[model samples]
Target: MTDPTQDFRRHLGQHEYELLEDDWLALLEADVSPALLFETAELAARYAPGEIPKTLLRVLADWLGEKGAHRWRLEALRRLLALGEDGPDLPAR
Candidate 1:
């Protein structure tokens, strides 16, 4: 049998990634490193493109800003926003 979480992680397309933002946030709330969160976000973004939600972006932005590393969040946000604006080639959310 497959590990459900691993399977979920492996097939995390944009819409699914967006849905999983809550899980990511919970991880963050549990005190996971900002760097790790950022990496996970990047992976989700690459998989799902424009599917990330604004709420998740704001959370990430706040975290990065709090660390005085706004550049990282800004860059990632820019990419996500651009993707959102242009629309992704994935299935409907």
Candidate 2:
């Protein structure tokens, strides 16, 4: 079966994609380091960051502080990979 996320982003076009990307980047805030962000550029490019939760975001920030940039990126991708759809994984409260 094909990945639906691929189809959805493609439909959004490059300009729209960049704009949506900016939204996701904002989610990371100042807690995450620029180096880690650059390292995980592929994750943001390939997957959706908009679906991340606040607790998870904090966890990612802490990972950067403790584990260093590269390790943090590996962990981030691993965490994000757990979210199957990546559209809006926030749980209903």
Candidate 3:
């Protein structure tokens, strides 16, 4: 099977990637929908402009919330990303 993380992994080097590995694996194992993964990828890209900000990554994780509820997670990411595009940077603290 294809590695689901491959898409987002390109944006993160080893050390940074390790921080999110567990959560990514959990989401994968739970069989989150493709749409959710897509939103996650967008969030990953948005979270990291050039250097991956660990703080923003943590925020991304927070936006994603827990597993099991893919729809809302996807929706949350979409709205967040949209707001990010239209307004200021993501919520930092």
Candidate 4:
């Protein structure tokens, strides 16, 4: 079976996987749909969290809150928790 995250992974630009941290984070702020936001968050988690910007991390957290309920929001909330920022409350899984 194919990886469930592959589709999300594909949403990332080549720059993101290249580990050009600045460009990667910038994509998060670009014109992307909520689905892309979920993918970007997942991509960042795959890398060293310490390398990600706190501002962008918080931005993702806030987007998840403002974007309302999508299935990925719950996963995003869990990942954002590792960034030590408060995100919207999600029901216990």
Candidate 5:
């Protein structure tokens, strides 16, 4: 099946995809854009392509929460919830 994540970002072409891949790789290394990461995770979950992305989303959500990025963490949790994950337990502001 065609990857929905790829389809979602297809309009940006391959260069953008490459850049997103780079961002994905650098997720834990630096202060990556939480919005972009959340988008990627959301797309990955909506597609339900495989386990890897789902696992990554879970990890990313926790990481964002720990990093005190509550908004992005809630977004990630929402995406995960759409995939039938446990409901979001958002932290206070």
Candidate 6:
């Protein structure tokens, strides 16, 4: 049997793996913190870039509203907007 967690870790970049592990552990242990989620999302945006899908964006939008971090929400929104524009900085893989 494959180890899903390990596989996930392998596909993720170092920073992405760290942030994702922290977030997953928090969720699994029911000890989630706003800061942790925020940091995870920020790191995802930075390291993974366009790796976040639209469905996840909707979820993040809701979470951002609930967490009262409109700035982060706006940043995510801007990324979505920029994705529709012509750009070479986007991740191509």
lDDT of 3 by residue, 20-58 (tens): 545465556767665665566556655545433333333
Q: By lDDT, who's the top model here?
A: 5
Residue runs of model 5 more than 4 Å from their true location after superposition: 1-25, 46-48, 87-93
Point to the candidate with the largest TM-score.
5
> Which tens-of-lDDT digit does each residue in 41-84 have in candidate 5?
66555543556455667788778889898787877776666666
Candidates sorted by lDDT, best first: 5, 1, 4, 3, 6, 2
Candidate 1 local distance difference test against the native:
0.57
lDDT tens per residue, model 1, 8-51: 36557424554476566565566666666666666665665454
Least accurate 10 contiguous residues by lDDT in model 6? 84-93
- What is the per-residue lDDT of model 6 for residues 1-93, given as tens digits with 9 covering 90 to 100? 444344334445654543554444433245345455444545455555454533344455556666687776665555555545333433332
Clashes of each: 1, 0, 0, 0, 0, 0
TM-score of each: 0.50, 0.25, 0.34, 0.42, 0.56, 0.39
On the 0 to 100 scale, the lDDT of residue 36 in model 5 is 64
Of candidates 6 and 3, the better by lDDT: 3
* TM-score of candidate 5 relative to the true fold: 0.56
Preferred candidate (lDDT higher): 3 or 5: 5
| lDDT per residue (tens digit) for residues 1-93 in model 4 | 333244335533343444434444455545466666555565666653454534445566555566675454566656656666463453455
* Overall lDDT per candidate, in order of appearance: 0.57, 0.45, 0.51, 0.52, 0.60, 0.49
Which of the two, 4 or 5, has more lDDT?
5
For model 3, name the residue pairs that clash: none
